[model samples]
Target: MRIFRFSLLTLCLLLSSIISFTLYAANDWYRPPVAVSWYWQLNGTVNENHDVDLYNIDLFDSSAELIQRLQASDKKVICYFSAGSYEDWRPDADQFAEKDMGKTLSGWDNERWLDIRSTMVHQVLLRRLDLAVEKGCSGVALGEVDSYRTNTGFYFRQDDQLRFNHIMAEEAHQRGLAIGLVINADQVRELVDYFDFALNEQCFEYSQCSSYGAFIKNEKPVLNAEYRRIYVDDKEERNSMCQNALTLQFSSILLSKKLDGSLYKPCR
Candidate 1:
């Protein structure tokens, strides 16, 4: 009888362990829904009246106090950090190894592609995630994740990209923060299952808005930004874009190239 009782106790302990592991796994798989009051600019003060559901701000530029203030106002704050590229202006830029750095991004003069497979780059990104957590961000926006499709100068393959993306999701989940992927519309189908939501640029202007429907199909929001010259210069085009954004069910906004807090014309 004693041996039987010991065995039963051991089995109970094992089952408890399994249940704990399952709960952790389930939490990692779950992602919170977002509403956009997103601002990419890191230099200026956040408008208190934006009344956005989620605000995406630079992880390095903004303080924890600002994130807390937003949260106090019933807003979720998502910290924006570049997981795939190296920006020279960032405070931790010097920590990136020279060998891990690749070709300069096409339009962004001060940034360069990073080798996602490099151990050094991974360490740096881990530190960034730690920072995001410390700042009390509800989620993280990983930028430039599709280096496999870009002129990365690293000869990276699609499999490499997939592995990198999965690792990113794992890291974010481990830290108890939701993870978001920002990608060009072309890679949406390939990465739809992994990302919590989609942050798209100019999908309406390029007529590739339909490609991001995969995220919507998964019951995730698609936050879009359109930078058409007419949308900025002409009021009529802005009104039309707002209407189109409503029909598409995208939380669309108009942002300038500098991404400063100048004008955030949301779709009303």
Candidate 2:
């Protein structure tokens, strides 16, 4: 009887350990580690042979087959979409109402800022999230989330932006998808806990790269892009820039301003 009791206790302890480990793993879900290699191709043909850990591509432009192909190669896909802007070129563009759109983007004529507080906009963004799940994307990179900081023509404040960003992160996680905070560097301290990773543009050029230290502190990946012509044309400068990126523990890439998959220099 004594031997049987000891055996039972050991079994129980082993089972408990297994269960605890499983729960810990399940909690990790789609969150990528810090400094994960990635390919950010929002335009042109997607070359999946880049041998990267993650691929950030257009949610609307990439076909389901392409995303599946990447997954077959054991790569994770992060779909990109403008969550805070209404682009007239998208298939769902007509769904946005005139009242929900604010000011047009400074350089992009076809795109306009969205009223992040609008019910219609929320519904649209939710639908987009659903599409990401349907397409088998492991995560999403929500662009234009910092419209509140711009002259969006709406009476938006920081509080409104925080609320909207929280809703987005909650919705993505509830659907079993990771969400990447894009370019709202100012909100990193507030939204870091809510997001899985981050993608930034021109932060290195504009001296805003330090804003992403919160993500580094949490061991989340911070993928940055530098579009300055010097980074592209000069090899010595590119090498120096990449060293700086490495010191910062950022997975940095030097790409064209268009992000057309033409030039890719990863800081390994």
Best by TM-score: 2
RMSD in angstroms, all models? 4.4, 7.8
Give stretches of model 1 more than 4 Å off.
Answer: 1-25, 28-40
Best by lDDT: 2
- Model 2, span 52-152: residue lDDT tens: 99999999999999999999999999999999999999999999999999898999899999999999999999999999989999989999998887999
Each model's lDDT: 0.82, 0.92
Which pairs clash (backbone N, Cα, C closer than 3 Å) in model 1? Answer: none
* Global fold similarity of model 1 (TM-score): 0.86
Cα-based RMSD of candidate 2: 7.8
Q: TM-score of model 2 relative to the true fold? A: 0.89
Position 95, candidate 1: lDDT: 100
Per-model clash counts, in order, read: 0, 0
User: What lDDT, from 0 to 1, does candidate 1 have?
Assistant: 0.82
Task: Give a tens-digit lDDT track for model 1, residues 1-268.
Answer: 4554458889999999888866765585436554444545555776656767878888998899988998899877878888999999999999999899999998888999999999889999999989998999888889888889888889998889888988987788777777887865767787777778788788888888898888877878888888787998899988988888778777788887567777777886
User: How many clashing pairs does model 2 include?
Assistant: 0
Per-residue error (Å), model 1, residue 92: 1.8
